[model samples]
Target chain A: MKFLDFFRSKRPSSASIAKERLQIIVSHERRRPSTPDFLPSLQKDILEVVRKYIQINENQIKLSVDRNGDCEVLELNISLSDPGKK
Target chain B: MKFLDFFRSKRPSSASIAKERLQIIVSHERRRPSTPDFLPSLQKDILEVVRKYIQINENQIKLSVDRNGDCEVLELNISLSDPGKK
Candidate 1:
């Protein structure tokens, strides 16, 4: 039984569960309607900066902010098109 | 050896890593300064609604939004004080 268990997938840990919950909650928090007016300009500026290096669609760039306690974190994710083609 | 391996602590799976990374990124994304202007009022309203049922601090209530593709999710978390205490 123990040997069989070894081959089986491991159960998720409490830490993993907490992480999943945090992610869902945080993602929801970022969608608030009160988003700053500067966000569009910031996104545009970042898009321009990234465009200089690679080809990507405006939709491929994502930016958001998150807060934990007193600390605020800025996040950016950019997806590039086919690298070989360029 | 297989039995011994089973007794050993399980290694974290890729899903766990993804969850951790997502949690950090999502938490960071939620801190944007552009938070809705009505959020405070909304929080206050929720606090009042919860207060009627249980005792809790303003900080104990949390709310956020998350978007996946075209779908937007609203999330709310509330922490209650001692349950037995009056």
Candidate 2:
């Protein structure tokens, strides 16, 4: 009976379950990336530079971040409105 | 003797080594980043513009040609080395 009681006591409790949930939440937050501080200024500056050459608004610029090996690649794509050329 | 033979067989064969070396050399020049003629001037212009604000080198900027479904995507990546810190 004591051995059976020992095995029952070894089972995870509500506290342990709550701790596990907390750990999962922490890990999930670690994996999810937050927006960078310079993102707004960088985007604004890039858009400004692009606008100098071609007429494009902030909405026209498409930005994407991709990973290659250990390096992170930030790609900025802008579509031009060329009337004569296809 | 079986254990000794097992340890001896752990070494890679010469043919496999040669194949690996060849694979590395061949793959080094494999993905030719063939791009448009205007790309050079565009990059130069963009870099010139970006240099006004950020002190970034040419290596920090990565340009790759990607094909997405039907349209060919031109990727431009500028690595901001942690804005506040060096």
Largest DockQ belongs to which candidate? 1
Worst 10-residue stretch by lDDT in candidate 1 chain A? Answer: A19-28
Proportion of the native interface contacts kept in model 1: 0.09
Q: Mind giving the per-residue lDDT tens digits that candidate 1 earns over A1-86?
A: 32123222332355532211111111111222332223334334434543443455546555566554222334455432232124
Highest TM-score model number: 2
Q: In candidate 1, what are the lDDT values of residues B1-86, reduced to their tens digit?
A: 32223222232365532211111111211222332223234334434543443455546555565554222233345433242135
Tens-place lDDT per residue, model 2, B32-78, is 23312333344455556545544566556555554322233233445
- Chain B, per-candidate TM-score: 0.35, 0.41
What TM-score goes with each of the models? 0.24, 0.33
Whole-model lDDT, model 1: 0.33
Which structure among the candidates has the greatest lDDT? Answer: 1
Q: How many clashes does each candidate structure show, in the order listed?
A: 20, 0
lDDT of 1 at B16: 38
